[model samples]
Target: MEASEIFENEDFLWRLVRHLPENSDRNRFSLVCQRFRRALLPFRTKFLFNCERYETGDKVIYLQFDPEKPEVEVTPIEWTGLLPMLQACAQTFPTIVSLSIMGLWSGSSSLPTNGLSSVLLHPRFAHLSSLKISFFKAGVDDNFVRLISTACCNLTYLNLRHCCPRLSDQALHSLAGGCTRLQFLKLRGHDRGPNTISDFGIERLLSSCTRLTDLRLCVGFNQVTGWGVRAGHALTCVVMENLNHLESNALSQGLQGKRLKRLSLHGAARLGEIERLVVERCAAEVVEELNLSGRMELKDGGLERIARECRRLRVLELRGVHGVTEEGWKALARHAEALEDLDVRDCYFFREDCLRALRENCQNLRHLLISSYFFLQQRSLETFCNARPSVTVKVYHREKDYVVDERVGLSGRPLGSRLGRRPTLYKDPVRCYKVRRFGYPWFEFLPFELVSLGIV
Candidate 1:
């Protein structure tokens, strides 16, 4: 075959694309949620060959030219410096769908709303749907609020979690007036803040943005009492964190009889209330995802009840709730035919055997996140993955620096085995955060193993 013909092959083109350099932008994953990853698509083309990179500076000393004791104050990076560099991306990728601007230093008050404000104001981003600006320091004042109101009208998903103290109830009101089509909204504010959002903001928002399906609001600071929890009909997914006593009841009353598909009582302590009010009220078959992360009060029967009711659950996140053992597993095994993603990261009581049902029944089971306390053996891993080849295991080992054994996985299966039962492809260990680096086990007979495995 000719060299041109070889290069022009579709497989060869994909091979070329796979080897390209990865993008250094850390905030990319913040926008893409697990809902997007539910398809289990390979992310090979999201890298950048042209995005600008940043570096730290080096200095010898502060200028003590004329004094015995001299001091200098280092200032935070100005947004003006970073804005021009990002313009290329904005200009090139004009119709950017999702934009998330997060993280401003604690003491620094000069919030850089300019960069995002410029992007939102651009005419090219008319179709932008998702905008998340979280953890930024104060000064989400009227200017930024007005900018979002006028510019981002077509937005469906907006997350302003713990963003700024200056983001008052009025800002939420403005957002409601403008973004009339928002389906997913997260307006979680900090506890210690000058700006407080009462039932006024939420009531206005619910009244205006009538198309809300998913909502996550922190009722920790603002006490939204009587009129706040009245509007709840089309809400399919609800995640309320840091809720107090009275607010929880109000939430229950509002959410009664709603056919919710996903419910997360995050940081909410009342397990009985959750089971009685939320679980009992919602349409059981429709509840696909349940996240009771950090709720220690969950009894085995509560989870069992969840299993019995929401049998079609696809995603289960029991991060710190440790009250289920065999009942939960058995329920998942029998009914969760659509189970795909499972996260039991901090559940110390759960073992590797807890996933036996999910392994057996759920044919499309792809991602499993478990604690290192769960004893996962080589044969067990091999047997599980051997049954279903598309499985990926992520073990959160508590050790600071963990290195796996070279021959820990089941590599050399028999030649006459199933076609899909190939070698175990281990995903990189996630540490600190989502800094994913590939894990390569050291093989003694590397070439021989490759040859035996028919890769060479």
Candidate 2:
């Protein structure tokens, strides 16, 4: 090879090496051949690193590191191993655009929040566009917010899950003020203290993250209620200066019109003024996948209003909407032709025909989960499969294997004259168990592959 070409090739290897995490793959590469090893010599200072796998590429990049790894003494040894690597990756790839730190609670039950100081604050992460920090116990405290603000300055997509003691309005303030570039944000399992997340935090978030195209915020738990109760304050905690915070009444005041393609709100039972606040205000038709499973009460016309407003709805979940009946579900399903996923578990007061109506009408349905004790019956199993040929049915019958589809058929004549005179329930000769005593019932285990009806 030409000397110039070799030099260019070496430079390229160095660039790729800088992006690799400190993991087994890099270790294997380092030992492959002397020339390869020498090419990787620049990164020899890295004692440990971690690998992050992306589903699309099928390639696992090892992010490498070095220097004195911080002593987060209280942090579990296994999880602590990645902290130094993360810090090093941030330093080396200052422009590293997409990064995610997930399952931080690995190797331990408790979340380690100490070693997170300079890791995110480093200028290297300033240009990071996509960031996801999962399983870390974070609070809305100044230090934590500072880390997020300083590090994810250019973030466009962010997912914060199960983090912190309480993520308050202050944290939302920092994110909205700083990460104005955000387009998609998900805040799941982020507690703002017990029954306390005022609209201040959500309003700031909605206001600041204006460019947000997808937003999922699960605010309250099962036990809170009312307009000012639990996460209820989140919706009313409106700020008009921010167009996104324009309340229903202030709709014409700000950016006046907007829409969301996907929305999921849980713990609706905590909302105090459910009838007026939730039903009247949230009348947007942009949702494609809507799950209202966490709310216990759906007032008289709540579900009907949703069916009327969310006309573009596709995937609807009314798992805990007990107030909804077969008629109400049918009303909602009428406009939901594009619907693909429907969960109707424990809405028992409704008739079984409601599901039949769905099977006949919602032909595009794919996944249907029904409770064992609800309106689900053995007869409807075949109807379901026949209606949506692409659908997979999961019945919850524990004691009986209700096989409605025919398995084996009676073909050839009986073997003997007297004993086999009459045709009996087709039994598998291989599965027929022998009896040691007289009058012991002849039993056989049916093959799961049997195609004909066994017993329903």
Instruction: Give the per-residue lDDT digits (tens) of candidate 1, residues 185-218.
Output: 8876666655566667877787788888888776
lDDT of 2 by residue, 270-327 (tens): 4333333333454355556666664566643677666667666777666766877677
Best candidate, TM-score-wise? 1
TM-score of 2: 0.61
Candidate 2: where are CA atoms >4 Å away? 1-77, 91-94, 104-113, 137-140, 189-197, 219-258, 268-284, 299-301, 394-456
